[model samples]
Target: MSRRTLSILALSVICATPTLYAQEAGRIQAGQFDIIPSFESSMAYVGNVAYARDNDPKIYSWRAIFSPELIAATQVDGNPVQFGYRLERGVYFSSTPDDYTDHFLEASGEFELNSRHRVNALAQYEDGHEDRGTGFHWA
Candidate 1:
């Protein structure tokens, strides 16, 4: 196809695509805190499975991932306090050895100090792993 025709086709395809918008979290009311629970699942294709040079053999794989998250927030003495947790699990149908599960934890709090200054604190932790070709490795 000519360059001009290809460009026009690409432009038309882009213009025909639908727009996507983020929806606000639907919060659930608990006894004292508001909770937000969500789940996400996706599939991905990896062009290279191993950290190999172009001269070496290349491997490709596909994987599916599922994640669930929950967040809870409340006010303690009019100060905001929150806690959150999320877990992600990956399943590789062809490359089982590359599958992994990850856990995430978070906590945050805000304290009002007098009428002027306030203190905010946050802590987060994640137990996750890097893909085969990602991150640093010791020689």
Candidate 2:
């Protein structure tokens, strides 16, 4: 089989595992952190890290993720758009290769819908590799 065909076959088998479907029934903790330095400058650094832990009797899963990015661009009145890319990887403490690996590219904007409610829109282009597939999210 070709490389892509073999990859698809493997992904299908891995995702079909029953353990991948079970959900944790107990407590779970999750955390995320991000640092962006001089984002409006010609050079910038972006990084994010997230972690989660779960404990349950029937199902169990934990996950940790890290994404680091860089960008270079020109300024438009101190608010400039940069061309950049990010790399994200994760490991599930109780899952398989098919249950992990989610990487994405994103663009975002925000607006004030009201005094108590604000609206934000984010566009993401996700590349799930052999695990899932490419998709988009608007939120």
- Top model by TM-score, which number? 1
* Per-candidate total of colliding backbone pairs: 0, 0
Worst lDDT 10-window in candidate 2:
39-48
Show where candidate 2 strays beyond 4 Å: 1-58, 76-79, 106-124, 129-139
Question: What lDDT would candidate 1 get against the real structure?
Answer: 0.77
**Clash pairs for candidate 1:** none
- Would you estimate the TM-scores of all the predictions? 0.73, 0.33
lDDT of 2 by residue, 40-112 (tens): 1111111211222234123344434444454333343333433445665554444444344445576654556
Q: lDDT (0-100) at residue 98 of candidate 1?
A: 86
Q: Candidate 1: list runs displaced more than 4 Å.
A: 1-26, 135-139
Q: What is the C-alpha lDDT of each candidate?
A: 0.77, 0.41
